[model samples]
Target: MNAYDLVRGLHILAVIAWMAGMLFLPRLYAYDAEQNAKPEPLKSEMQALLRTWQTRLLRIILNPAMILALIFGVWLFWLRSGQGADWSFAHQPWMITKLIGVVLLFGWHGFLAGQRKKIAAGTSKYSGRFWRMTNEIPFVLAIIMVLSVTTEWTLR
Candidate 1:
């Protein structure tokens, strides 16, 4: 009904879209890595298919969703600050921890994008197992971020 509420809803929707891509792209990369075990011709074809999927997902969904989420999240933060929310919240231990988690989330996103660049250059070195292992990062970060926001728990 209000502007902040609408922006918050949109931010949640963007985050969901972005997180879905984050969860999926690494699995696709794992499959792409597995393609290395196939016959040469099949490997090339599968690599091409995977590259297309990666490009489309990044450009059409993931990048835009991330941008939207950041934009709206900053807006919400500013709105709260303007409405007299205490600036000291930023220094709270739980808030600091959540911000650290968010920074790591961005770093993880960059690492995955770098992997995609390597794939494009035919020089990726990471294995399917590695990707599978890293896939849990986003899920874990999401859980921590959600819990921090929902519970507003603080270190005493």
Candidate 2:
């Protein structure tokens, strides 16, 4: 394998790690919401545990993975450009679509981070059902991104 292959592999791995956290975090939030409805020590204990898990997942896995994925993904784009790949939106609509999806994923990550802060503060307003519904966002975005890359779909 060559440099491009290596970078692409790393990008994929990092995205996989990021996606794992993206998919799991909201489910954790749902459980946290459920726990919030309980009473006494159990509520406090579960909230603390969930908060710890969310914090660790965000700080340890999600953040690093996202950074690495973005770095390697940009590297791959630069390498592709160097290799004479056309990056024009008209020429590669799929790349544009993939980019939009990635941007949305980044936004979702930020949203989750903000929610984590609210949860830690015991000020979160979202319900378990809300989190459950939002959990599908990453999965749907992943499918769109994968199809965009694999198919190289165009507007025409």
Can you tell me which runs of candidate 1 are displaced by over 4 Å? 83-85
Q: What is the lDDT of every predicted structure here? A: 0.87, 0.92
- Residue 21, candidate 2: how far off, in angstroms? 0.2
Candidate 1, 22-49: lDDT as tens digits: 9999999999999999999999999999
How far out, in Å, is residue 73 in model 2?
0.4
Regions of model 2 farther than 4 Å from truth? 83-86, 89-91
Query: Across residues 75-99, which tens digit of lDDT does each residue of candidate 2 receive?
Result: 8888888755665643588898899
Clashing pairs in 2: none
Q: TM-score for every candidate vs. truth?
A: 0.93, 0.94
